[model samples]
Target: MPTDTQILAAIDAAFGDSPRPEHFTHYRHCCECAEHDELLRHRDRETLQHADVGNAGWDPICFCSPEGIAYYFPALARFALAEPVPELDWYGWQMVFHLDYGGAENPFFQHCAPQQRQAVAGLLAHLLETRTGLLEMDADSALRAHGVWAG
Candidate 1:
């Protein structure tokens, strides 16, 4: 099997970009990293097709995708076992999101009201456009640095 670093380089090359040496991760499998940008780009069809565009089926558990569903139930149950919500940071949220965790179980997802789906979508679009890189290097950081939160 290829080492994680090799996988990252291959992913970066596929995107026509050099490997970002500065993107060292706090966790081994960092979420929303630059490498993921290219990976997701390759799966544009699946991502676009499964995107929660209409928000009509936004359940409290948010187990829409079987992939997301797997993580969702387990995470929710774990939190229930522990009691109280966990205070996850931006990167943490991205990890869960990218890991297929969704629905009301996600603290970030719970923050978005049903009517605010469009706003959430808008922010998501901006994040992808800006390339958060799952760290302080991307557009989200630039926006946060400039005191701009909402999209």
Candidate 2:
């Protein structure tokens, strides 16, 4: 397993140049939500590193545009690498890997460039190896059931 620092380095290499979006949320209905408001507070900022994404919660990530999700992924990954809990569900990391065509694909995971996909795969593999309890998942079953294979 790669060290956390190495995993983060891979993330930076893959996603560092992704542009920030004007609005982080895709749907207008989400615009009225408190989480959306929080995300908006960082819209004018150059980087989201200081944004409290965990406070904004997972809904924004689930509904955001491809650019929006890419912009936030580094911060999201950082949060997951922290002391994650099952209830927080790794801040919706699984949502990105879920293969359901019935409105379940994360725009970032679905439309990301190949390099981005590899970076995500590395991150997921690292998480599964070191944080199984925090992820609250069986590796093989998750890969089989959710189409979340990284190998």
Candidate 3:
């Protein structure tokens, strides 16, 4: 099993060159919401790194643009792994691992490049190895369904 440090490093290497969107917006055109406004306020990756996932009263995972989604993924993963916040855990799991519950597409997989998708596969593998009981479904089936298990 890979350590958190290793998983994070993989995430960084995969996403390092992701382009920042010129004008960030929601995945859909929705009425102005706090989460959307908050995301727009942060222009740089470093600033978004400091964003509090809980501040918007919701996860804001699906509502973000592809660029913003990728940009925020690392921070969200870090919080989910390192911190004991259940909301982050649930939302993070939903965003990355749960395929049947949310949007028709896995936003991370759909928005990310091939390498980025591989990195996410790594992240899921790490989670399965380390946090055995957290995932709700048949783990192997879920991994297989997503085709995230490289092995």
Candidate 4:
């Protein structure tokens, strides 16, 4: 498991040349999001295992995948803060219930207007873009730093 400091360092190194205010801001947000996703994934995975062993009453929790850490977490933070209402595709709807309402019930789903949903969708999109951009940036930086840019 990478420590937060290490992750941040990697992010910094990845973006050192092109570091913008947005990069730093998104990096911080991504770290927090990753932590949240990790907590959720751990809890969910444990609950699933327990259920498989006949513990039906086990509390379900979320578990973060490396991909989740790299992607979803930051996206969620942006979405929640911005409170955008986006069109619900199948996956998006699932995310709302599976992720957004996994352990705790969110009143936002019930009370949010159409505009709110749109905002949420926009936030999700932003998160996805940030995650993709970070990964690409990191990969490019790693190649250059290691003198493997040609490969």
27-46 in candidate 3: lDDT tens per residue? 24566444464565554556
lDDT of 2 by residue, 33-118 (tens): 54664665555324553234443344445556677667666776676677655444454344334422233254455677878877
Where model 1 places Cα greater than 4 Å from the true spot, the runs are 1-100, 103-112, 132-151
For each of the candidates, the C-alpha root-mean-square deviation to the true structure, in angstroms, is: 18.6, 4.4, 4.0, 18.5
Local distance difference test, each candidate: 0.31, 0.59, 0.58, 0.31
Selected candidate, larger lDDT, 2 vs 4: 2
lDDT of 3: 0.58
Candidate scoring better on lDDT of 1 and 2? 2
Tell me, by lDDT, which candidate is best. Answer: 2
TM-score quality measure for candidate 3: 0.70
- For residues 33-83, write the lDDT of model 4, one tens digit per residue: 454434444432113221211111221113333233223333333222232
Residue 82, candidate 1: C-alpha displacement in angstroms: 30
Candidate 2 Cα outliers beyond 4 Å, as residue runs: 30-38, 41-52, 55-58, 85-105, 137-151
Candidate 3 residue spans exceeding 4 A from truth: 32-35, 47-51, 54-57, 86-91, 97-107, 137-151
